[model samples]
Structure formats: structure tokens, C-alpha cells
Target: MISAASRAMLAALALAAATVTAWAQDFPNRPLTIVLPYPPGASTEQVARMVQPILQERLKQPVVIENKPGGNGSIGTMFVARSPADGYTILLTTNALMTIVPHVQAMPFDPLKDFVPLTTAIRGILGLAVNPNVPAKNMAEFIAYAKANPKKVHYGTAGIGSPQHMAGLLLNREAGIDLVHVPYKGGAPAANDAMGGHIQAVIATISSTLGQHSAGRLRIIGIGEKERFAGQPDIQAIAETVPGFEATSWLAFYAPAGTPKAVVDVLNRELVFALSSPDVKKKLFDLGLPAVADKPEELDKRTREDHKLWGDIARQMNVRAE
Candidate 1:
């Protein structure tokens, strides 16, 4: 019923739409690189490796992981921040890089402006634990013990500005305790001290000490979360005792800013698939990490809110460079 000219125009429009679709889908025909901001064999690498194989299977392409750690994740973060906005390069990073690093450092790239959200890989819990030699059996007892013996109970942090530092600072402010902080190069050493009874306590990833807690080496007092970790249900949350106190952290993926929406959508869909698989969830759970697959918008909102929250807390408690 249509005239030839009208029919030709309609066909042209259809072709254009098809071209856009193809353009979007054609991306990532090659291997994709996921830049990790942590060192090799780190938690970030483990999470990346766990999801990368599944994503490769689903996409029929490889998702490669590269470690570019240094300067408290600033170096790797900036590398990803400056990468081409073509979805070929992605960043598997912790919220600490987004929420904690920017507040404390003069960075080459802005965390909020330089990246496009892919998806949050996981939400992990952190716990406050002490050597078995400490006289505190629980949160209340620990606070009382620290209050009675000030500066005697030393606490170890992963680094001066790391999440362990944030938890330690938050704990001190909330529990009204002035525990001396000793910074280590990373979480392993700080946790080692806690297990060896050298330092009284240390705030670390639940997975970092899950083995110790299981082996009955260190005494876990409180978790910096609302609920008990599935991996460590015996340990109560700090919120239960501190009432209204909570500090949860996570890891997520981000593409360079201005990456195509179609590519981002594809990545998000694959991540959802990865999270839904029982194998993937089990790996994370065993590592004491809770799986949380968030859309791009949800991740953006949470990161922004955390930045504000941590900023205010750091300021109120006078948690400055150590």
C-alpha cells in the first residue's frame, strides 16, 4: 500500500537502527582487561579471577585481570581513570579507593568523574578482633578494659589511611576509647600481630581472620556491620552493642567515563549472571564476602553517600594523617 519512495525511506530508518545495535554489540569482540587496584594474590584478584572465567564462558570472550597496585590504589585507579572510554579497560576496585582515598590524597584523577559504573562485585564485612591475651571477651568488656587501661591496648591497622584505619578510628570514636594505633604495610601483617598476641587488637577483613577465629586463635569482638557475617555467625556486630554504629565496605567494577551504554549494559548483565550462580556465591561466602550485584545507578548513589559519611566521621573524630 505504500509508495516506493515511502517504502525506501522506511527501509533506511530500519537499517540505521540495526546499525546502532550492531555497533553496540560489536564491541569487546576481543579480550577485555580488568585492572585491579590491589597487589597480586589479593582479595581483589581473587574476586576478579572468580568472576572472570564465568563471564568469559557467557560472553565467549576473556576478561583479563591486571594488577596495578601502589600509592594506596591511587596508581591503579588513575590508570583506569585515564584509560580509553571504550569498555576495553575496566577497574575492579574497592569502595575504599572511591570513599577513603580521595578524601585523604591529592589525586591525579577524580574518583566520581573519571569512571563509568559497571557493577558492584561484592559487599564484604570487616571485624574488630584482638589477641586472646587481651582481657576483653566482648564489646562492652573491651571498651571497659581499654578505658581502665588507656594506651596500653595497642591496635594495628593495615595502613595509615586504609579501611582498617577507618574501622579503628570509627571504633575509637564510637566506643569512647583511645586505643593507640600501629600501622602496618598491609592487612596480613596487622592480622598476624593480632593472632600472635603482639598487639592487643586490629580491625581487618573477616576473611583475613576467619581461619584464626575458626581455629580459636583470636577473639572476634565486633563486626563493623549491621548483621553477623554468614562465615562468622558466632561473632556479633558492633552495631548491636554501639547502637546506630555501622561501617560496611565493598568492591565494584567501573569502566572509563563515557563508555557506551550498550557495552555497560552487557557487562552488567554478565555480572548478574555470575552472581546468581551458586558456585560464584559459594566462593565469595567462603571468603567471608557477601555477594551484592548492584546496577550502575545503585552503585553511584552508594559510593557518593559513603564519601559523605566517611568524610563527616573523619572530621568529627579528627582522624587525620598518621
Candidate 2:
């Protein structure tokens, strides 16, 4: 026998549970938005556009992409962090905002607390490319050249505190060279400057410099991966020349924290399917970003590990947001 108040409390709990279940079941009955925290021409936007139609088809709703670029990706990320947790709005961004940015800048939202990891879509390859005029043919030669020149060797990157910047710093520490960092508004500009001989070298995503490298305008000497990238085996890993050196980037999906688990499951299922498609895989590979459709748990684990890894590196390198 229960008191009247106790009975009412139990009934209320049951009603709440039923309501949540119904909400999850009816999710995305309206339009869904994928928020990208970068400019229109970014690789992140390209990837989002690639999957938008597939996600819409599978979810039986219109999926829209919204770009909110600023503060090195924090502006749009905060927007999603504060969005309703109904799974209507999700974030498609790089690991930099979560793992690297917070270590250097003051963030408005807590990365580990404000969002839930969905899955990683692709792995971006960052490469170190030099002007064709540079006499360095490979990583070893480039290191020697930089060592000989000291601070005279200048390397450009997307911006200060960016992954490319960190890679350049790591190379400086590992190779014992003093390559001055020239921060640019974006990777394309940085690569363009390098090609024009304005900068001796540029650390940026391969997609931005691959064409120039192939055209002999800029020469990609090494990549920031533990092993050679399969698509371009000729380019050696910077790790090969400087043991234990690696600085890679990836793009992943996330929803605001407290989004229902059932809704997350639905999203994960469709995302995995779209990413696993052969068409998508080939397109991503051609763009120098290989598809990686790992499970949500795997993404979560990777995020946590990278957060710690980058934090340690930032402390060691004294990296601060510019």
C-alpha cells in the first residue's frame, strides 16, 4: 500500500519515460541541421555536403548544412553546445576544436562536457611542403637545410595554434632546427605563399598543396603521420626522419550533451552507412582524407586520448592561442 503522493510520483515517472520514448521515435520529423564551424570552402564543409543527401534520404527528412566560422571554430561549436538536445542540430567539425584549441585558447563551453561524440568521418593528412626552389628533396635534406639556415628558414601555416602550427613546432623540437612560423589566414594562402617563394615551407593539409606538388610548383617533402599515407607512398612520413614525430588531424560528428541515446543511435546508424559507401570513400580518398567510420564509443575514446595528448604537447611547447 502506497501513500497518494508516492503513487502520483510513480505515475509521473512513467509518463515522463513514455514521453521521452515518443520524442525519440518521432525525431527529425522536421528539418535537421549539420553545423560546420568553418568557412564554405573548407574540407569540413565539403565532407558535410557529400553526406547531406545520404543522411536526408536515410532519416526521411531534409538535412541542412550551416556554416558558422569564427574564433578558430569555437563560435559555431558553442552554438551547437547550447542548442536543444533533441538531436535536430548536430556538429560536424575537426578534432582540433575539441582536443587542441582548448589547450591554447579560452573556450566558452567545456568540450568534454558540452557535447557527445558521434563518430569520426575522415582522417585529414597534414604535409610539409617547400617551394620548388628549396634544395631539400626529402625530410632529411629539409632538416639539414633548416639546421644550416637556423631562423632564416620560415614555414607558414593556416594560423597560430592550428594543427599545422603544432606540427611545425614539433618538427622544430624534434629536428633541433629553428624554422620561423609565419601564420596565415588559411592553408590555401599559406601554400600559395610558399609556392610563390614568399615562405620557404608550409605545413598544411595535403589537399591544399597536392595539385601544386604534382605540378612541381611546391614539393611535399614529408607528412605528419606515423607511416606513409597509402594514397601517396612516395611522400615519406616526417616520423621516418624524426623518430616519434606525428601530428595528424581528423573530422568527427557530435551532438549537444543530454541528447537522447535512442536518437543518437539512429544518427550513428545512418552516418556509418553513408560513410561506408564506396562512392563516399573514393571521393574522400581522392581529396586526401580517407574515410573512417568508427563507432561512437571509438570516437569518444579517441577524443579523450587526443585531448590529453595535445594538452601535454601544448604544455611542453608553451603553445598559446594567438
lDDT of each: 0.84, 0.92
What lDDT score goes with residue 224 in model 2?
93
What lDDT tens digits, residue by residue, belong to model 1 across residues 1-322? 9999999999999998788679778876889898988899878888888888888898888888899988778888889888888788899998888887677656687778898888888876888988988888899899999999988888887776677788878888888888898999888898898888889898888878878877878888899988777677778989888888788778998999988888899988888788768998998988888788889999899888988888777677666664
* Each candidate structure's count of clashing pairs: 0, 0
Clashes of 2: 0
Name the 10 consecutive residues with the lowest summed lDDT in model 2: 158-167
What is every candidate's alpha-carbon RMSD to the true fold?
3.8, 1.7
TM-score of 1: 0.92
Question: In candidate 1, which residue pairs clash?
Answer: none
The regions of model 2 sitting more than 4 angstroms off are 1-14
Q: Can you write out model 2's per-residue Cα lDDT over 192-229, one digit (the tens) per residue?
A: 89989999999999988899999999999999989999
